[model samples]
Each structure stands twice: as structure tokens, then as C-alpha cells.
Target: MKNKLTRIICTTLAFGFLALPSAQAAESEFSLDRLVITALRAEMKDLDTPASVTVRTGEELKATGALTVADALQFIEGINMYSQGPYGQSAGRMSSEIVIRGAKKGTLVMVNGAPVNMNGLFQLDNILLENVEKVEVIRGAGSVMYGSEAFGGVINIITKKQVDNSISSSIGSFGRHSHSLNLQAGKLAFSGSLVEGGETGNVTSTSTKYTNYTGSEKISLNGAYRFTDKLVMNYTHSKDDINKEDISLSTNNRQQYSNDQESVDRFSFQYQDDTLLANVYGAFREIDYYTRNNDGSVPLPTMGGYPRKADVHTNLKTAKYGLDTNKQWEVRNNKYLAGITLETEKYEQNKVIMTKASAPASPVITNQQTGPFERNVIALYTQATHQIDDERKIILGVRGQKTEAEQGKEYTQLLPQLQYNEKIGESSSWFVNIGKAFRLPTLTEMYVTSDRFTGNPNLKPQSGWSYETGWKKQIATGAVKATYFVLDMNDYIETDSTAAKMYQNFDQYRNQGLEVSWEDKLSDKFSYTVGGVVSNPQAYYNRNWSRLYSRVQGTLGLHYTLDKVSANLSANYITDRANDAPPAFPVSLTVNYKAQPETTVFATVRNVLNRHDVTTESTPSSMSGYFYGAPRTIEIGVKHSF
Candidate 1:
């Protein structure tokens, strides 16, 4: 089977390139002028960063019918998704526990230059993707600029700034449909979208076979005014709401409803001159979520019966302010860039859960409020980039952070980073980076106490030291890049499941991995990319090492265009994995297609051979199993712009 799969993949790549000539010519057209300045506080080319990164453009997203950020990122290397089921009951509950270079969740996610840390849980759903202009993902620790919860890496969503007026809509199987509109005039831009979908098992063999519905609405507006050629001011606002119905087969055939709403407002000022550039930004955000579960056997209080119900609510509010400045100077034949940044963030979370009884006779009640928690963090950082001669460059960076909790614990950290880039040839470069990063426990991780889990007030911070090296080559045909990285983590925070719920403590672990990718245009009409990643992740406790570590992932893509029609096909695979513990079945072969630049259709036969794949097992004995990848379903949708 392995040999056959390999042969098929190779055949597809060869055929895809043989059909494209224009694509081959466009591959060699490289100019630095197309690059845009990013607020990531770093000066980097698309190919220069010493980490694994992937960028998805707005056009590519529309072509693939990607309704969410996670959907669009599904094809990227080293990324995966988990869900309990399909539709509303399990809708927003899907876990995007992004694992980059073997680092799991706890990664930092940002939107429009602001941190969207909803209690250290990255749940910015794909509904937000409708208003996104681009996405930049960096794999590995990035605490120098982002601070806490960056131990895994960073995902930045850049919202759209409309250049013109446009509207798009689509409808498809399983009661799926959507519509969107964008408008821009002068210095102002506004956009809005609505999506509604439902599923009933009758349509396909893979359908979840339950009544499920999901609806979402979102809006964003931004404006910029130039005070002078070197100065500008900008303001932006965004809001989103999502509602879903839950359908689960395991527990008494109960139905549930979940709703999530978020709003963000931000303002920024920028100034630039021949040798200096500075930016200041301030932002505020609020997020709220509510869920209600109802089992069939439970009767309403007015009906004189017991009510088997659960209600959970959470609210989060955050304020952030920051400033950054950069200066450039030249001496002899060398040039240098020095920059410094200061930022602070205050975050709070309030949660409540309740259970009730049907009136008449039975009387029942449950604790409603889980203790509220708040945390504040402040950080200052600096970085310097020096060009030594023309073939070699060096970067030195460091950050100092102070964190305060409402419970009276104060924590501080000093992290440093060093990197070097050497031009091996006119078209090739080699780069290496060594850095230290840390992550503080989340508010819930520190104070929340519930029937499902327990919080640990004494839990120490988790720290990681990582070393990375890579090579990038841009040839006449296309581009090739490869990287090798290893991380040694101390005081790793993991849950202990021996108790009824779970506890937290310091656990040691190590992650080592390699990634390689190649993209080439065989001809003007054909282009292809092949990439793969392999890693060994393990845990250590009480002076003993556990062997759970080994994962292999890979991808191959092909594209062809003829006049007004364009076609794309790609397949991704992940081998069975283990962490010196039990082995999980492999997940392989997800294929997607886009016909005509505006229409996308996909079919993913997860666990192709119908294998039971266990992707994640939480420390508390709560396990998430993917028993047969989504049952082989077909998704078709069309989009139009005017």
C-alpha cells in the first residue's frame, strides 16, 4: 500500500508540471519590491526567517472555499485539527491544538496586530477568515515579541482593507450556504458577512446523521488618515457572533446550543523618516460564550419532572497598549537596524455553571460561579540587525517581562536570542537561531476548580531552550527550504490524572524535528510543491525518560491554469505517532480541488482505510479519538466577486 501511494503521488506531481508553461516562467520572477512591512517587529524577507513559515493570500483562500482560518491552514505542513463530531453541538468545541515542531496548544494567536489571548486558549474560529486579507504563521517559540503563551509559536491574522466594492455568495450540500460584501472609499473600508449551514445524515454516507445547524455573522471597519508624508493615524473595529446546535450520539441523544461573541477596537499612529520609524497602538477586546445542554429524559420545572441540564458561561475582557521604534544607520559598507518595544496587557476571565430542577416537587441546584481570575503582564524588548559585509548578517535580541496575578504571585523572566544568516551563493542562504522562551500558567490553569478539573496555584512556569538551523535556495526553477530544530523544556506543565479530575506540576520533555519543502514550476502552466516533516517528542519525569516520540508528515500539491480556468489538487499525509506510550493509527491522504479561480470543492476520506486513529489523550484520562476520518464526505461550493 505504501509503495502504491508513493507511485500515485509521484505520478500526480509529474503530470501537474507537464501541463503548465506560464507557471514555470512566473516562478523565476523575483523582486524584493513586492514585500510589505509587517508589525512583527522584525525585518525579514519571505524567505529569510530562520523558522518554518507559511503565508496564504486572500485569492488562494477564496479559491479553496475556506470558511475559517483552520480550514485554510489544513494543507500547511505540521498542522492538524480535532473535533468531537460535526455541526452545532460540537461546533465551536473543535480543538485546534496546533502542534508546531512538536509544541502543542498554548501557542499565541493574534489579529490585526493585537493579542487575542482568551485565557491562553486559541479559539479564533474560521468565521473570522471571511474578513481576513492574509495569514502569517511562524512555527516554534516566539516569546521575544509576543511574550507568554508563545511557547509553541504565533499565528497572525491580517484583516482585509478593501480596495474596491465586491460581494460574494455560495450554497452547497448538507444545508450549507454563505454571503459576504466589502466596500472601500477614500481612507475608509467596511466589510460584512453571514454564513448559515446545517446537516442531516440523509445526504451522504459520511454525514453525522443528526440535525445540526450553525450560523455566524461578522463585520469589520477601518480607516487611515495621513497627517503628513511621514506620519499617519489608523483606527479599526470588528465584531463577530457564532451560534450552533450540538448533536452527540454518546449521551442520551441530548441537544445543546452554544453561542460565542467577540468585539475588538484598536487605534494606532505611525511615523517614519529617512532613518527612523515608530509606531504606537492601543486596543481593547471582549469575548463572551454560553452553552446549554438538554437531554430528552429531562422535563421542564413546570412539567413536574427532573431537568437534566447544564449551563456554562464565560466572559473575557482585555486591554493592550504598546509602542515600537526602529532606526537605521550606515557605516562604511555595513548597515544596521536597531529597535526597541514596550507593551502591557491586562486580562480577566469570569465563568459560571448551573444546573436546575423541574418545579412541582423535585428541588435541585448547582454551584454557578467559578472564581474569577485576572492577570497583568508588562514587557520590554530590543533587537539589533547588523549586515556584516554583504554575505553575512547577524541578529541579537532580548526581552524582559514581569507578570502579576491577582492571587499575589509575581513572576519575571529574561530571554535572549541570537541568529546568523550566511549567503552561501547568489541564490542560496544558510541560517541558524538559538533562543530561550517561557510561558506562564493561564488564569484557569491556576485558579479554576471544577468537577472536570482542578487548578494548581503553585504550578511553576514552563521554559524552553531551542536551537535551529536551516538552508534556503532559490533556483531558476523554484525554491527549496529545509530546517532542523530541537527544544529542551524544563518545568513543563502537564496534568496528572491519577485523581478524579486532574492536577498540574512541572514535567520535563524534549522535542526535536526536521522540515523540508520544495516548490518548482515545471512549465508555464504547471507548478508543484512537495514537503515533509519528521519529529521525535518525548516526556521525562522523576529522572526517567519515556519514549513517546515519532511523527512523520508530508504534503504534495499541483496547480495548472488555462485562460480563465484554473485547477489545483493537493494531498496531505500524517504517519502514526507515539510518545513512548501507546501508538496512534496513521492519518493519511486528504485531497482538495479548486476549479475555475472562484469555485472550490474538496473530498477528505480521513483514515482512508477506515482506521481508528487516536490523535490526543489529555493527562486527566480524557481522551479524544478520531474513529474514521469524517467518513469520506464531499464538499462543494462556488464564490463570485463583483
Candidate 2:
């Protein structure tokens, strides 16, 4: 499919902005008093932005009993997590996955407005809820403000700088345990956590073959310093290590291997002031894969079939460095924004192998290496807002991206966005957003060829447009919002159906959906949040359509507070997905008691019903059970503030 329809929608939206006079801004999806930063790329109340955005405060985060940002994302309406077993570390290449509307390459995750979706993986694993200030979610295209990867949505986790001093500890099922500390002294503050867990089960096996996950270790640290009232500096670092055992039944004598250690390390420095926000970050992720038995031999991935020929050890690593800055100014009823982004990424791989023969295998090793392949990106963007009248407003945004890479030709594209917000009354409002979205192929998809994947340097990028319209109303005791969105994409990227499955581009894909959410206070000390999504996501191939995943997903949360105790219960529901899979329902509860003015005790329960079924597949439509949800786990911890 071509992108001709996008031009039509863009023209229509531009006409609506001029013809529709009495439009500006009005209600909030959460509360009228709430402020959203990501929706507009600046500090503005939710009532003033023409986007579907959700803001979760620090207090509300604690109520959900979530230790990490990924845990809480699982319950959000249009978001999904395909974790192999738990949140931090899992068993496979695509483990601990996060996607919006089942598009893994579309959503972008950030910390304080800095992109951290390195190597096509979400970067939220290092952020602890305790050190967060707020989380902002913007659905639909955000390429105008961010970059190409923000095609589906954007998740921004804002951390607290000067936090209260505290120390905590907890222990739970499957040798799960953690320790954390947060402290602030004058203008300096620091927070960090160490988590460890062990699990041995059928987390990734599909044919009754034996599989085991030995253990995983994770560490996260954050620090900040305020040099002046309007200037601050921040630093973040995280490390992860995972160990597992693998066995392939199709191989001779059921060949075996051990994941000696699969690890990732990330660090970043951020600088912020009244007029500017910037970050410099780096990441390193590697996997030490080795085969066991049979003269250290393993099956080699081939076009015809898997052949047991190479005795190989694999090492894969990705290194990234990025810097993005934003500058803004105000002139009467208009606000202008100018920004620039620069990033460089490299993919490195090393394979140590020796071919095996019938009699004996060579004792010498043959080493194969791919370049520390580099890709550089340069982008410039701007946004301008004008108040048409007392109750009407319009926004214009655009971005230009230039790419120079190792294999593909030099590529460049421009993305533009238009928005209009209208105020209906003192308590209700409506808005419309029409924009362009895109996604470039990652290095792994174009440069790295391994045992299971074939690279395609000829792959083209994916391009599309997003159309969204929403309305918000504030009731006496609660707020309600409804959003309708559609996505039309061309040259949709996927794996080809050949003996050697190389990455390829498809004809077209379309996704449209409706989302509804309501938050209310039932009583003086009781409240609830409800959200649901109805969507039909399908791909067009060979002039036919096919479903992506479940068509319906919903969430429910109940909160109660009285005296010194508070409790929260949350639930997620999904209809039957593709490939004869079963429906999914996962629920959790958190209870906290303020033992003293500076101390508190809390307990959390996950997977209350313990339904250990297929959580997600390798692909959106695959039936080869690749992952499952986390089992029931209990944790009790105490926190003391000094």
C-alpha cells in the first residue's frame, strides 16, 4: 500500500483547524489539576493538550504495589508485556518484551525525555517505582516531537531528584529477594536497588523437552545534584545477568548447552535547566552462548535445515551513545520549541567455532567476526502553538531525520503533525491529532546473521500515518475519556516465508481501535480506575487479512485508604488471542500499613489465581508457546525513613 491516504487526512486536519473556530482546550483524562509533559513536549495541564495521555503519580504508583515500571505497564489499556517468566531477566533473546498494540518496534521508552530503547528493547527495567516522580504515556504517533521509533506510543518515566531518605528489604518465592536504599543530603541525592531471583521450570519449552532457568541478578543506581534553583544534573546506571540451560531434542543425542552468562549494562548522564534538557548515554549487552557434549558441537542454522556441524561459542554486543536537547521560548499567546538530536550505535558479534567430522573434530578453533558496525542519526524538530481564540488552539509540529549507516543507502525523511483542541464547556473538551509515523530497520535486522536469523540489508523502512480523535469529561466524582485511533502502514516489515527466513517488507497493515477509561471516587476513602480497549489489528498479504492478537483487553483497579492503612487491587483481562491460545487474566494486590511517622510495612501478591498458561508467543500469530506469565509470588518488606 502507498501513503496517498495520509496526504488526504493531513489536508482534512488542516482544514478542520481553520474552519473549526470555537476550539482551544478543556478537561483532563485523569484530573483537571494534573500536568502532562510528554503529550505536548512541555509543561502543560492535560486540559491544554490535544493528545490521548495518561499520567500516573508517584503515590498512585506505590498503591499498585509495583516494584518496576514494566510491572505497572502490563495493566495499562493499550500496552502489553511478553515476559518469559518475570519482569527483570528471562530466558530468550526476546525476553522481557514491551509492545503497544503488538508492534514491538513501534513504541519508544524514555527516562526524563531521553531515548533508551537500545537495540530494540525497552529500557524500563532499571527504573524502580520508589525513585520515580511520575510516568507519562502518550498514545499514537509522536515522531513530530521525538523520533521515528515513537510510531505507536511513548512512555516517559520522570524520576525524583531530592527524595526522602529510606532503606528497605524483602524476600519471596523462588529465592526472590531485594534490597534498596534512597537518601538525600542537602542538594545531593542517591537511590539504588539490588534484586536476585532463581527459577527452574518449563518457562520456554514447547515440545515437552526439559528447560530450566538457573538464576538472574540485577542492579540499578541513580543519583542527582541541584547546582542552582533551575539547573540540575543526573546520573543513572544498571546491570543485569541471567543464566539458563538449553536442550534441543531434534539434534543428535538431544544436544545441550548452557547460557554461561547473558548480561546488559546501561549508564547515562542528564542535564536540565529552565530552558534546556539534554542527556548522554551508553549501553552494552552481550550473551556468552556455548554448546555442551558431542565434542562441543552444536547445530548450525542453514537454509535447508538445521545441521549439526559447527562447535560454536557466540558473543553478541551492542554499544550506543546519544544526545538530544530541547530549547523553548514563549511569545504572548504562542510557544515555540526547537530541538536537535544526535546518536551513534554499533552492533558487534564474535563466533568461535570448529567443524566436527565422523571420526574426530579439530582441536583448533576458527573465529568469525563481524565489524563493530556503526549507524549515525541526525534530527532537527520544531513545534509551535497558537491560541486562535479564548477557547480554541492549534499546533504545528515537524521533524527531519537523516541517517548514514554501514550497509543501507543514506536515507532521509520528514514527519509533520497537526493538532486542534476545543473547549465545549467548563467540564468537557474534545481534540484531534493527525500525524506521520515511521520505523527504520535496526542493525540486528539488517546486519547480524546468526543461528536463527538471516539479515537483509535490502529491507526498506516502514511508513504510516496516524489519525486520532478524543473527548474528555469531568464528572462530579470522577473523569471519563474516549479515544478512537487508526493506523495505516506501508511496507510493513516481517520475516519472509522461505527456507532461509530473511527479513522482508510486506504489502500493508492496518490497525484501528477505541479506548475508554474512567476514574472515580466511590467514597471518602475509596476509589477505582477502569479502562478497556477494543481493537482489530490485521495485516494484508496476498490480498487477504489476518488477525494480530486478542481483540479485547481491559483493566480494573480498586483503592482503599483509612486511618493509617491502604490497600489496592488490580486486574488485567484479555480475550482469546491468535493460534488457538487461551484467554488470560492476571490479578495482584498490595497492602501497606504506616507503622510510624517515618516507617511503613507492605506486602504484595502477584498472580493470585496462578494460571500458568501461554502469556505470549514468539510472533503475534505464532502457536509455538515461547513465553508464559510469572507464577504466584508473595513479598513482605519494611521501609524506614530517616
Candidate 3:
């Protein structure tokens, strides 16, 4: 593993056209003066925030023909966008999930400065780029500023506020078509998109087989109005319908898998000025699903009786509302920021089953039930920065929170963070940061006790300490960022596999890693970026820490433009994986040309290398119980602005 990491790093530096670790869009530069808000609730320069950050612009994403955010985020070094095929091809896990430092549920997701993660997970494949303005990612613990579910990091998706009118359409492989529209009138701005498509031949593996067709329909709607220069309101909605029919070779059965419908709605009102920023918002999410075999087949009778057909349905719904506010003050070159947050979430689940076995026995007519749960949280947080000299500064921050759950005992905590940064010169600086992080269990993880799977309401919250140190330098046309981080976690949550076992608090685990990246322009029409990460993120399994992540993961990208034509090539290589790991290497290419002053044409080819990377896995073994990657496919589109 060490030799492979060294060789890759050396080769990347020698090539100069590196896929730098910073996933910034080519149009963006990590300059010291760039403004960011995810690291701290208040606006601050990248150099002043003292953390590893990356930003991707929506314009560049659309121009590059990225189908969704998941397509672009896969190239970032520290994140693993484990997905069951882009769009709606495979239903492996639940949705497109982002895992940082081996923690899947520890990443906090937000939009426009408000928490948007619903029911412990958020869907990324449905968020088209047309409605986004930019994405900001802070790659370390943020629990001191944000209360819970930030044990790994924070990702904030900023939607477009300024209106730009345009209409676009596209058609791709596997009988796919999509359209988008954006318009502005008076004080209102709107953007919406619709997409549908899939292929039967693209997703398959040597052991598992996806013989039939899989497809999906996706929609997004967003609108905003400005009441005044300092006040604004916005509403965003998304819906997705997915279905797939496949042949399960392991079971030797023909079955169908799907999440019939998934949707989200968000409404927010905000007031912002030079000294204060506040938001009041409400959000809701629903996921409905039913799974059964293609034919009406019943389970084999266990008690010497005939079996009968069955119908089963399951659904999950959650409603969340919150208020977040921040006030800033500057005194004698020092800065202070204070804020308060109040939030409540209600989670409900419904299940219905109908079946009858044994012809002479009494048949159950109907079965209906629900799981109801609620949690309320209040938090106060503040940050203070003191300048000891022109080149040195110190930051101290803390958060206090009280949480109450309907099915569990009340909990309270106080978390703190500290950082110190010093400048070496005008273009370089180094910093050290230490903080505490925590993650609260989801409603399903705590209160949903059942026959097949049991949940324990008394499970404790996972808590940890984070230590990070990094250096940043603005070198010539681009920049360089290097960071080393350690995460010490205690009382990790684990679910025992014993029959009808419950969720429980287990032992300890740690994640430690090193990251180095660079992005720059080589000439007037060409550019390259390179970055890599080496880490051994461990998970507490059985009696000890096991399951290390991919030891060496590197990103690759190159962009070229001349006149009205532009092209981009991107890929990722990962090796030294877990348990008989299958090979993983996929590449993508995109080309664009300006046809007219207001019209543009583009083409995108996914899986350019046609690599048979593993997309979905059922076990640790590589020989079976898995699905393959997206076959070589091409898409064409055109956009016109009015």
C-alpha cells in the first residue's frame, strides 16, 4: 500500500496535469480572498476559516454536462459517493449516499444555510445542476458550530438566486430524455427540470444478473421572491419515481425492486443585513415502496400448510422545521459571532400487510400499523476571534444544546473548538484546529421495535474529538493545500445481527489520513489539477477495529478550450480496498461547442473506459452478490438563452 501510494503521487506530480484534491470547478480558484459560509455560520475568507474547503459552480457543472451532483462529486479524494448506478439504474442501498472518513450518517447535508437532510439520508441523484448556484464542502468535523449529525463534515448546496432565463433539452442512451426551464418576472425567479431514462444492458456482473429493465422519472422545482433588498423567500421541491425488474442469480428467482415514489418540499424565509443573518424554514420528505416477485408466488409453508399470496407496503415520512440566526460584531480588529437555533422533527412510518395461509384456517383480513416518533432540539453557539499580531490570530468557539425525544431520555451537551493560524508571508499560512463532534441516532435507529429488526430507545449518542492541522499556499497561477486529520470516536453505534437484536452502543474507532492537492493553469487554453489521499479509516467490528477504506485513492482531470469549443476528461482510480475487492477505474468525457450567440451544443460520454467497476455489493467477497458499472453511453443536448 505504501509503495502504491508513493508511485501514484510521484506520477501525478510528474504529469503536471493532475486531478487535484480540491474539487473546485475549473472556473473557481482557491484564492485567499474567496468568501465562504459553510466552515463558519458567518461569512469569512477561505484563508481566515482555517479548514479544508472546496466549491463547485453550477455554471461549470452544466457546461461540463454533468447529469447530477453525484457525477461530479465522485472525483473528490476524501468522499465516497457509493451509489447503485447513476440516475435510477440499480436499487442497491437506499439512495446515493456520501461517506466521509468511513462515516455514512455522520455527514450533515444542508441547502442555502439550512439543514435539509431528512430521515437520516438525502438523495443527491435527483438534484439537477440547472437549479443549483454552487456547492460548498468543508472536509472536517463541524459539530461545534452545528449541533449534531456533523461528525464527519458539512456540505451546503446553495441554490441560484439571481435569475438567468434559458431553455434546454437533451437525449441520451437507454431511451432517455430531459428538459429544463428558467424564467424571471418582476420580483420572482423560477427554475424547473424533468428527466426520465434507463437501460437494461448497462448494469450486470459475473455473479449477479440484472436481466430486465430499470428506469426512473425525476422532477425539480425551485422559486424565489425578493420582498426587499434585505429580505427574501424561497420554495424548492423535488420528486422521483423509480422501478426495476431483475433476475437474482444467487436466489435463482425473478423479482422486482423499487422505491415507488420519493419526494421533498422546502419553504424558507430569511432576513439578512450587514450585521445579522437569520432563516425560518419548514421541510418535509416521504418515501414509499413495495417489493414482490414478478409472479404471485407465496413463501413456502413451514407448518405443513399451503401458502397464499401476500401484499405488503411500507412508507416513511418526516416533517422538520427550524429557525437559525446569527449576529456579528467587529471591535478593535477582533470579530465576534453569536447564534441560536431551534428545531423540531417528527418521523412517522406506515406498514400494511395482507395474507392468508392454510385453506381451512381463518385468514387475516387486513393489517395496518405505524411508527410515530418526534425530537426537539435547542442550541446556542458563539465564536470569538482575537488578533495578537498582524500575522497571527486565535479563534475560540462553543455550542450548547438540549435535546428531547418522545421515546428516549433527554440529553444535553456542551462542545467547544479552538484554532490558531499564523502567516509565513503574503501567500502562505499554517493552522491547527481541535474540536468535538457528535451524532444523534435517527428515529428508525432508536424507536422502531419490530419482529425482524429491533431498535433500542436507550441507545447513546456517538461522540468524538477531532484534531486537524493544515497548510495553504497560493503558488503562482494556482494553489496548494495539505492537511492531516485524526478522528477519535467513542461509543460507536452498531446493530447486532442476532435474531431480533437491537441497536447498541459498542467500542471505539479512529480515522486518520493525509491529503495533498494542487490546481493550476498550464497555459492559456489548457489546465490540469491533481490530488490524492492516503488513509486508514477503521470500523469497530466483532471485537476490534477492522474494515479499512481504500488505502490509495487519486483523482484525474484535464480541461482544454479553444475558440468556441471546450472539452474535459475526468476519472478516478482506487486500489487496496476491503476484502477481495474488485478493480475500480472509471472515466468520463464531455465536449461543448457554441453554435450561435445564444445557443450551445454539447455531448457527454460516461464510462469512457468501459471499466467493469463494482456498483452494488451484497458481501465482502468479490466473486459474487454484486452488480457492475455503467456501460459506455453517450448523451447530446442543446441550450438556448433568451
Q: In terms of TM-score, which candidate is strongest?
A: 3
* Index of the highest-lDDT prediction: 2
Tens digit per residue, CA lDDT, model 2, 1-642: 224643553365345323433321211123544688887877887767798887887667666667888777777777766666565344435546676665547888887777767667755666788788888989888988888678889988888878889999998888888899999999988999999888745566567454566687878888878777666666776766666555555642344545544565655566666677776766666666665444234433431243433356777777777888889888999989999989888888888875544444434558999768889999999999999887789999999999888855677879999999988787778999999988888888887777666888887788889999999887888888899999888887766656566778888877888989998875556667899888877776434576666678899877766566666777888885665567787877777778998888889877766666566743433345555666677889999999
CA displacement after TM-score superposition, residue 212 of candidate 1 (Å): 6.4
Which scores greater on TM-score, model 2 or model 3? 3
lDDT of each: 0.59, 0.74, 0.73
Expressed as tens digits, the lDDT of each residue in 1-642 for candidate 3 is 655754664465345334323333343233434578889777776676688876667755554457677666776667666666553222422666676766647788787878877657766665667777888888888988877888888888887676779999989888778899989887898988888877545365445655444777888888989899888898988887776656766775665544467787888898999999999998888877665444326443222253423245667788889999989999997989999999998888777664554665544446555567889999999999999898899999999999999745788889999988888788888989899988888877788866655788888888989889999887787778899999888877766656666777778768888978787776666666677878877767557666654666787767766567667777678776665557577667777777997898988877765566765422142124445566666889998999
Regions of model 1 farther than 4 Å from truth: 1-42, 46-50, 81-95, 126-133, 200-252, 255-295, 300-367, 500-503, 541-550, 578-642
Rank list by lDDT: 2, 3, 1
Tens-place lDDT per residue, model 1, 1-642, is 865864675576457546544522221232321232342354466555556666656545433435566545556666644333332112332334555666645467766555655555444443345567777777667887667777666777766544446666655555555566666666565555565545433111112323333555555555556567777676667665666555655553537666777776777777888788787877776777777765666453222354433366767666667776667776765555666666665656566655555443554444345444556666777667677757888877788888877679888999998878888767778888888888787666677666666888888788878788888887787788888988788886666645644446547768788889887766667666688888876666434555432467787655666544455555556664552223433222323344545443443322333333333433213432232223223344444444
Q: After superposition, how far is residue 426 of candidate 3 from its true place, in Å?
A: 0.9
Rate residue 205 of model 2 by lDDT.
58
Residue 40 error, candidate 3, Å: 1.8
Question: What's the best-to-worst order under TM-score?
Answer: 3, 2, 1
Determine which window of 10 residues in candidate 3 has minimal summed lDDT. Answer: 301-310
